[model samples]
Target chain A: MKSEARKPFSKDIIHIENIDQVCNDIIAKLKMDVTKNLQRRGAIVGISGGIDSSVCLALSAKAFGSKNVLGIMLPEQDSSDDSRHLAEKLAATYGVSTLIEDITKALDGFGCYERRDEAILRVIPDFDKKVDKAKIEIKQNIAENIPAIFSITVIKPNGDVVSKLLPAREYLQIVASTNFKQRSRMSMLYYHAERMHYAVIGTPNKHEVEQGFFVKYGDGGADVMPIGHFYKTQVYQLAKHLGVPQEIIDRTPTTDTYTAEQSQEDFFYQMPFESMDLIWYGWENNYPAEEVGKVMGKTTKEIENIYKSFERKRKTTEYLRMKPIF
Target chain B: MKSKNDVKTEIKKYILEASLSDVKDVEDDALIFENGLLDSMGLLFLIEFLGETFEVEVNDDELNPKNFESINNIVSFVNNKLSVKV
Candidate 1:
C-alpha cells in the first residue's frame, strides 16, 4: 500500500517535523485546559522499562520538566531483571523520579488462591445484569498460577496507602485493589500536580488508545496524553532516535500483573505485537479491518472480530481523544 | 433462616466474582491492598456493585480502606451499611 493510502486523522498536523510546535501547542492548551477547568498541572507515568514509556518520559520531561514528572514502576516479582534495571536506568538517565513498588504483596494480603492458570472459554457479561464481567478472572486459580506482570496502578481516597496486587484474577476484589493502585497513583499524581502546578502526562499510544485496551479510569486515564497519537512502531522509532537502550527496544511488553512470564498479550489470546500493531494501525488509519487483514492474510474470523472490536473501541475511546469534557 | 444466610452466601458469591484475587479463604483482617490484594478502586467497584446489587448506600467515609481489607470486613461493612440505610 502506498504511504498516501491513508490520510491524516485531521488537518491539525501533529507530525514529527512540527513536534516542537505540537508540543508547545499541547502545553498551552493544557495550561488553558487547567485554567478554564480550574485544575492543576500533574502528570503520572507508568514507566515500564519499555520503549513506549521511555519515549513518553523523554518527551514529558521536555514538555513539563523533570520535577513535575512522577515515574511509577510496578514490576511483578518475577519480572525480568532487565526491565527493572532498564526502568531505573531510564529514569536515572532522564532524571525522572522513580517508585519501585511490587504487586505481589497485595496478592497475598487479599486472601487469593489460584487453581487454573488458563481458560478455554471465559464468561462474557452483559450490562443488563449489572454484572462486572472482568471480575470473573479472579474466580479461578489463575491468581497464583500466573506470575505478576507489568501494569500502572492508581488508587484513590488515601493515595499514600494504596494496595498493590499479583495482577491475577479475583476480578472485583483485586482489580479494584490494583485499579485503586493505578487510580491512587493517578490520584496522587493529579493531587501533586495540583499542588506543584503541572499537567498529567498519559502514556497511551494511538494503538492502545484506539483499541480501548486500557481499563477505564485506569492507565487509560490521564489528564494530558503526550504520546496518545503515536503508533507503537512510531514510539519505538522515536525511542531509538532519542537513544533509548537497545534491550528495551527488544524486550517483551507486559502489564506486570501476573508472574514475570506474563505479557500484555496473555489476556488477548496470544496475539503478537507485530500482528496486533499492523491490524491496529490499519484500523486506526481506517483501512477497514477486512481489507487490512486480507493484506496481512489474517483469517476471516480474525478480521471480522478485529473490525467489531475496533469499531466498538473507536466509539468508546472517541471521548478520550476529544478535548477534555471541561 | 435463609434470609441472612442466603444474603450472606450470595454476598460471598458476588465478592468472589468481583474480586481479582481468588476468594477461597479470605479472613476479616486480610490487608487487601498491602498484600497486593484488592486494589482500592477495585474495592470501590466491588462496593458499588454491592450497594447497587443489594440496593444499599455506602457513605463516602465508610468506604475507608479498613472496612474492605478482607471478606469478613467486606461482609460486615456491607451488612452494617445496608442495615443502617434500611
Candidate 2:
C-alpha cells in the first residue's frame, strides 16, 4: 500500500489564525440552530465567569441580540464568590439581563451534602462536614498510563489538611451525590429556558465534550452548544476576540464544584490546556507520537502514554455521549 | 518472604475476588483490564491489597500499566518490589 503523507505537527497546529472568522461562523450557526431548528426566540446561558461560558454568553448576545440573551448565575454553597462576581461582570459587559439563583437550598433539600459526607466518612472516619472543606483529586499522573487513583483531601477550620485514597464504593457515592449540583443547575436552566422560550446554551468546549469531562444529563443537557467545537485553548482565543474581560480570560479554569478550591487540571485533564490541546490534536489526527513529543518538549514515551490515557477516557465515558435508547 | 508460587496464588485469588470473574477462564497471561476483569477502581483495590499483603510499596512513579497489565506482569512487579525491600 502507498503511504499517506501527514501534516507537520507543531504547537501552532491548534491555533486559530482567523479568530474573527471563527467567531462569526459560530455566531451564524447559533442563530440558525436556535431560531429555525429549535424554534426558540432567544438564548439562555449559564455564566460561570469562566472563559468558556463568558465566550458563549458573548456569542449568544451577538447572535440573538443583547436584549434577547439571558445570563443565569447558578451559585451553590460550595461555589466560589469570584464565579458570581465574574458572571455579573460578564452579563453587564454584554448588556444582557441576568438572574441569580442560589441552588444551595435545592441541594440541601436533596441531602447532597449529607450523602457526600456519609461517603467521605467511610474513608476518613473523623471527617466533619460543617467544619471542614473537601475536594477529590487524582493522585497519579496521567502520563503513567495506569488507572487513575483518586484521593480526597479535607481541610480543617484550623488549616490542617488530611488526604486519603478513596475506595471505589465511597468514590462512586461521593461523585454521585455531588453530581446533584450539576443536575440541579441543569433543571434550573431548562426552567428559565422554557419560561422565556429560549434555547439553553451549553458552555463545554471540545475537550470537555469529547473526553467526557462533564456530568451526563446535568451540565451536558443543552439545547445548543456554540463553543463545543473549539478546544479549551481555542475557547480562550474566542474569548479574547470577543473582548472578554482580561481578568476572566486570565483566570485558571476550575471545577468550581468543590468547597476546597480545585483546578480543572488537578481534578482532571492532568495537563495544562495548551499542551493538552496540541497533544490531543496530534493524536486525533494520527500524527506520530515522536513528532508530537518533539514539538511539546516531551519524550515519545510520554506522548504515547498521554495517547493511551485519552483512549481509555474516551472508551470509559463513551456511554455519556450516547443518546437515550429507543 | 513468600515463594513465587505463594505470591502468584494470593495475587490470583485477589484478582478473582475483586473482578468477580470465573477462575477457569482467567489465565496467568490474561490482560486484566482489557478482558473486562478489573477496572480502574479494581486496580486501586489490588494495589492496596499488594501493599498490605506483601508489604511492598507501589510508588506513584512505578504505576506504569505495563507493570500491571496482566497477572504475570503483576506477579513480576510484586516480586521485584519484594526483592528490592530485602
- Write the residue-wise lDDT of candidate 2 on A90-154 in tens digits: 99898999999999999999999999999999888888888899999986877775767688999
The candidate 1 chain A region of ten consecutive residues with least summed lDDT is A138-147
CAPRI-style quality class for the chain A–B interface of candidate 2: acceptable
Record all residue pairs in model 2 with backbone atoms less than 3 Å apart, i.e. clashing. Answer: none
lDDT, candidate 2, B1-86, per-residue tens: 99999999999999998888789989999977767687676787787788789987665456667788899999999998888888
**Predicted candidate 1 versus true structure: per-residue lDDT over B1-86, tens digit per residue:** 12555566776666556564465655446655444444433554565566557765544334444566566666676677666665
Indicate the TM-score of model 1: 0.52
User: How far out, in Å, is residue B15 in model 1?
Assistant: 25
Superposition TM-score, candidate 2 onto the true structure:
0.89
DockQ-based CAPRI category assigned to the predicted complex of candidate 1: incorrect
DockQ of each: 0.02, 0.43
Alpha-carbon local distance difference test for all models:
0.54, 0.88
DockQ leader: 2
